[model samples]
Target: MPLGKGELTTTATSLHILELIVDHGWVTLRGLVEETGLAKSTVHKHLSTLRANDYIVKEGERYTLGLYFLTVGKRAVEFRESYQLVEQKVRELGSRTDAEVDFTVEENGRLILMFEAAGATNESTFGTGTEFFLHNTAAGKAILATYADSKRDEILDTQGLPATTNKTIQSREALHAELEQVRENGYALNDGECVEGYRTVSSVIKRPNGSALGAISAGGPAYRIDQSRLKNELADHVRSATAEVTESLVEAQSTL
Candidate 1:
């Protein structure tokens, strides 16, 4: 049977409610109705269904996400066979560089933080599972640089280059030039592009077949990561870390 438009709309509405609950931490039925601009009756019906499924919990007038989300998130991470090795390398890179380290992957044309390790000097404001625009981040660029031109163009076409800061690349031609440099250097750099007063260096991790699996990054305040260090030391460290993970992934794949 063909699915109707009403069913699709209902599914989207339910997911939107869930996103609102995540953003606000806790929400009231009235709050959801107001935020969504939906009728109170419509909001309450969705809330009732979610509560019955244990996806949310109600305390008096407020509703909060339930432990079921944690269960699902954990399973999602464990399902990635190389996640354990990736975590270990990220932690090691953080310790060695004394900078915030992150492992990220592209999903649905956006970047998702899969693992992170905080250093003494820098603690990440964005946590695991946070989504970020791909064009403005070092990990995103590194992953993009490893993609075939056709694949890269498809993502760029779908997700238009939106600027987050004045330093962000807004033109496809300029971004393509930068990605070409990333390919030549085996790494990428973000200088106050995604966030002001911060900089990052990243390198891509490859699968056994030489395709990009993801990217790893090291980032910190601009004052601490000067141009010299960003280009040489941090860039080299990130490349080394990614190389280690790529080799480990290859070895693991061989065993399978």
Candidate 2:
């Protein structure tokens, strides 16, 4: 639902129910009723529609997300030339640095994982469809820096920054300060913000007008990325990755 919108269309209600099902994996109509507070009749009606469309699958009484989304997600990834180009770069970066690499995008105001590659050294905690805090992770913060002020405020107002680790930025003022630093440095750093022992360096891939296309990151255990390495070596790799991805995307767009 859009912020400050008190009325929810039945379709929106149904979509919400579907999203809940997607997040929970499997749920009963009764469970949906309890979670959504929708009447059994309303929930059943929506579930019937969903099941008929193959958006949800039913087994006895439990409902699971349908396979239709698998095709859709695959097609979507292929449709975005950036994903293909970025995936190769992410994999290359991961293989070279032996650090977990990720490509993340802001969609519907959520920082979502688009692609992930485990480094030979094994250092990140991201996977496809992972939605993370915009104020914490390096990828999140890098993307956040590109959002307009009003849009950024709307996101923060909707998704309040919460402490994931002791080092996570909790205050809006602090986050703003950090975003400024990200702009100056052309990259962002995550020093045990999302996970206690993890660190990351990220840079945003931006379009010509300076809006972000997404962000790319290299992350690993804090022991593997000390402050000096985070600022220097890791930052260099992340900047290069973002530059390559952005340049490829611009070229692809020009061809289109």
Candidate 3:
């Protein structure tokens, strides 16, 4: 949730410190103070509290995130209703296509990678828990294509179409036009939009009611996944995988 007026500033400070630690890998008390511009005593107190709670580990003067975060992250992934099915399909798609496969869902108007399966090449840098904008990736576009215009516009308004690469769609009108094609094609393509020299193909997974649940994507280096292969082969592979996952999700929901 967005921070509201009169919310606990202390909690926000603690989370901000944690995020800094995550971004930098490890940090010292002085580093946190410098980064946050908070008083040294305040930073020390938050660090001490987090260390006591096992949320961070201290090595000499440096602190890193603790294994407790891993435990919590595991529970969060398993808590998703479609995680199991998505996991299975991600693995299968990776093996079948020899490209990195990812299953992503929208949270707070951003795409979050929920599950990922490394391809044989192991060249992909993305992993589970990676968060990115919805206008720069094939998976995000696939999900956006499935959303109602009002819902899609809301997310776009909240998270403006920032350009990641020169090829990224930066205008709402242009994105809407591509999304229309994505709807008709049953898949979305990312041709060096998010990361230059990389390409991706994705298809949306839908719930029983036909609302988008998430998206499944396969991506690789542009040379390996050239335009022809991206449109025909990889697109088919991603669409097939998403179709299977959507079918299984619908069946499971019906039983429940």
Candidate 4:
């Protein structure tokens, strides 16, 4: 039997529906039809297929992701294994410095906050599941700065340089030059770029093969960070903590 182009397109649409469910958490059948611009019948058919595969589930009129995604996400993180280690190190860093430490992973063209911990002295208006602008945060720059020129340019082009604060980098040329400095220093620093009073310093978390896995950052108010006065002290602390986390990751990888 010959398979028609329409059938092939239908299969692709089904996969896209499942992906949308996973990405958006929950969506109504009507919303899926509107978002996908597919026929209502087509959307229903795809949703049924996804449900049959356990990739999605429906509760009354609403559909959400199912446990299959949990299994998939767990396996993916388990394969990498550094996610938990980095989380532990961030907590340790926060406790030792008495400041807020956050870890973020780059997924699907965005920085996803994976873990966070705050010490007694820590104060930053960020928490888990907070996604930040890739151009305006130290953690984001740390991950992006490690990317190849073309790859970085593509992201910048898509996201552009939306200013979060007056200090935010606006020009592509200026950001390009700043990323060059980050590459040279093996870390990135954002002094009130994301928020008026908040500052952060971060380094890329890399695999043994030098691929960027995520970033670890320490953030607090400008009154305390004072980069010019405390540059060496802060950098030394962050560098040591990052190194420790990297080493732990290496050890864990061996056991895998």
Best by lDDT: 1
Q: Which lDDT tens digits does candidate 3 get at residues 147-223?
A: 88999999988899888899989899899999999999999999899999998899999888998889988878877
| Candidate that beats the other on TM-score, 2 or 4, i.e. the better one | 2
TM-score of 2: 0.91
* Candidate 3, poorest ten consecutive residues by summed lDDT: 118-127
Which of candidates 2 and 3 is the stronger one according to lDDT? 3
Q: Which regions of candidate 2 are displaced past 4 Å?
A: 1-8
Cα lDDT tens digits for candidate 1, 1-256:
2345667878788888998999999999988888889999999999999999999999999999999999999999899878888899999888888888899999889999999987766677579999888899999999988888898889989899888899999998999999999989999999989999889999999989998889999878897778888889989999998898899888988988
Model 4 spans with C-alpha error above 4 angstroms? 1-8, 18-25, 67-71, 120-124, 127-129, 221-232, 247-256
TM-score of 4: 0.78
Better of 2 and 3 by TM-score: 2
Q: Which model scores highest in TM-score? A: 2
Taking all chains together, the TM-score of candidate 1 against the true structure is 0.88
Whole-model alpha-carbon lDDT for candidate 1:
0.89
Clashing pairs in 3: none
Candidate 1, superposed: residue stretches over 4 Å from native = 1-9, 34-39, 120-122
Question: What value does the lDDT take at residue 118 in candidate 4?
Answer: 80
Q: What would the per-residue lDDT of candidate 2 be over residues 106-180, giving only the tens digit for each residue?
A: 887678898888866574575688888789988888888888899999998988988998998989999999999
Query: What are the models' TM-scores?
Result: 0.88, 0.91, 0.90, 0.78
Q: Which of candidates 1 and 4 reaches a greater lDDT?
A: 1
- How many collisions per candidate? 0, 0, 0, 0
